[model samples]
Target: MFLSFLYQYRQYLVLGVYVLISVAFMIAKSDRVNVNLKSAAISLISPLQKVVNNVSEASENFWNSIEELKKVKKELVRSREELEKLKGANIEIEELKKENERLKFTLENQKKIEFQTAYAEIIAKDPSNYYSSFIINKGKSQGIKINMPVIAYQGNQKGLVGKIIEVSAGSSKVLPVTGVGSFVGAMMADLRYTGIIKGMGKTSDHVVLEYINKDATINFGDLVVTSGQGGIFPKGIKIGIVLGFQKVKYGLFYKDIKVKPIIDFSQLEDVYVIFKQSEETFYQEGD
Candidate 1:
């Protein structure tokens, strides 16, 4: 019976023995016993304290890294935004530069004109017949009128462009010299021979100079100009250069002459309208 009781209370007995040893040490008055007890207590707690410090250090480092990453991300976003702004500014600057170049070209050409003229920009074109007709930005409100001769300055030389046919309050329609219905009294620059220059439809690259005297000396590359014979185009305006001449199809008295216009109609952008002429210049014949 005593052995059975010992077995059941064996765990309790061991715990009581440990408690008694701890109390005995507490009650001891010897200096060496006290020192040994303090040493054992410090040894047991040292590893736990080290573990706690390591945990604290690791957590602090993790949080610090997170803060740095946030700062870096913010800076990256700011940099992207600034780059976009710079791109937009650069684009605007390029556009302004192109506008300035166009203005400079217009101003330089305007200086070469001698008559009372108005500067006008080409506002629109006939898609069906590009070189035949077009529209200008100036209109009757700006003193633009029908039959006002339009001319383009190119390569430091002035060339005949067309004339105003229709005028509105804010815009005017122009019939180019290449239009089928157009005609101008033209003369050769060197020979001083005069003829009527006629447009051979929109598709033709050269105008037809009709009623040339068969006996007149005709040459290729002869410069043609307005003769001021009709009451429309002013005299001395460059028209074209002679390309070739052919015998009239059915007549013996005239030559069918082709003249290449001086102005490149495809590249025309700005032009001057001859609103008024000098007093000394006059038309010799009715338009």
Candidate 2:
């Protein structure tokens, strides 16, 4: 009967026995036993604490990496913007440099010229009459007048361009040396052989030095200069270089010498109009 009772209450009996043992242990606890208990508890919890710390550190590291990546990306974008700005600045600098160079070249040419001249720009040029006629950006307002000699600077020497034929308030028309109606009294620079220079238009690409004595020694490369005879152009200004002489098919007392003008009409941009001619050059109104 007792055994049956024990079986029926076995669970409760085991629980009671455990409570009694815990009470006994508490009441009879010693320092060494408590220390051993603490050690065992720490040993069991150490791995779990380490796992938690490792997880926390890993999470912190991931956030730090993300922040570093964002900083790098932002810096890259800023750097790209700065590079583009620098490129624009460089282009502006180059343009300024080119402009400065052009100004310097013009200044150099102006310094070498001796004529009391007015500097003018070629504002209008007709392609059909490119070498024959052009317009300047200065006129009566700038003291420009009809028959004022226009000249260009090239290779450190002044060359005859043409004469102004028409003038307005702020603009003037120039008849170039290559114009059919243009004529200038020219002479050989070294030999003093005098002749007349006559234009044959742009198609000829040259001028004819007429009435040069056939017996005169004509050098192929002799420089032709204004003789200042017709009172139009100043003396010593370069007109052209002698290229060759044309053989007259008929009997003639003069040699037809072909001369290439010193100035390259195709490349003409700026010019100096002799508003106040030298003491030797007297401006005549017509022809």
Candidate 3:
């Protein structure tokens, strides 16, 4: 019975001894003992504390990277949208500049012309034709009529384009001076010599000036303008410049003068129709 009691009491005896030792150490208050205790606790706990801190820092860094990626993605999308808007704005600005230039050129020519005028845009051309004759976006409703002069602004001067050959309610067909059916009364700019300007048939590259006065002087690079004789075109409209002479019979009163037109039909966009000649107006012609 005594041995059984000793075994049961052995656990109590060991716990009491440990508690008494801890109390003695707390109450001693010796600097050397306190230092030794602190060093022992730190030696055992420091590595465990460092491991916990590393785990916490790694989790924080992972979250921070995810947030930064989100911000960068948002910025990229915004930048792309802004870039598209800027591209569209640039295209619109370019279109406005071209329109402004065209209108300014036409306005300057208007100031120099004396006849009543109406502006018309060239709308279409026959795909089969090569003479650059095309249709204008105006017709009888806009006071356009057959034989009305079509003119365009080129460089600092206005060039003679053609005549209105066919008219509909909304459009008119223009016959360029180079057309085979075209003819105009033209005069030399320097010497006041008169002649008839006519288109060469399909094979010729230049138009011909027929019946120039024999007494009048002709030179290369001479400018020609309308005489306003046939009641068709206004006077002072630019026709073309003399290029060379065509071979003909000697001592004839007229020589075949080749003319180079001033207007560049390849770049043509708009034209002005002279609505009146001298005193006769388009209204009177329509009647």
Tens-place lDDT digits, model 3, residues 96-145:
99999989886777788877888987766644544545777776678887
Report the lDDT tens digits of candidate 1 across residue range 96-184. Answer: 99999989886877777889899888766666854568777776668887788999988767999988876655566688888888999
Candidate 1 whole-model C-alpha lDDT, 0 to 1: 0.79
TM-score pick, better of 1 and 2:
2
Q: Estimate each model's TM-score.
A: 0.60, 0.60, 0.59
Q: Which lDDT values do the candidates have, in the order given? A: 0.79, 0.80, 0.75
Pairs clashing in candidate 3? Answer: none
The runs of at least 3 residues in candidate 3 whose Cα sits more than 4 Å from the true structure, single-residue gaps closed, are 1-106, 130-132, 201-205, 249-251, 279-287
In model 3, the worst 10-residue window by lDDT is 278-287
Predicted structure 3: clash tally: 0
What lDDT is obtained when candidate 2 is compared to the true structure? 0.80
lDDT ranking from best candidate downward? 2, 1, 3
lDDT, candidate 2, 16-94, per-residue tens? 9999988877886664565345435534444454466568769989998899899979977986787697864765677
Q: Which has the greatest lDDT?
A: 2
Ranking by TM-score: 2, 1, 3
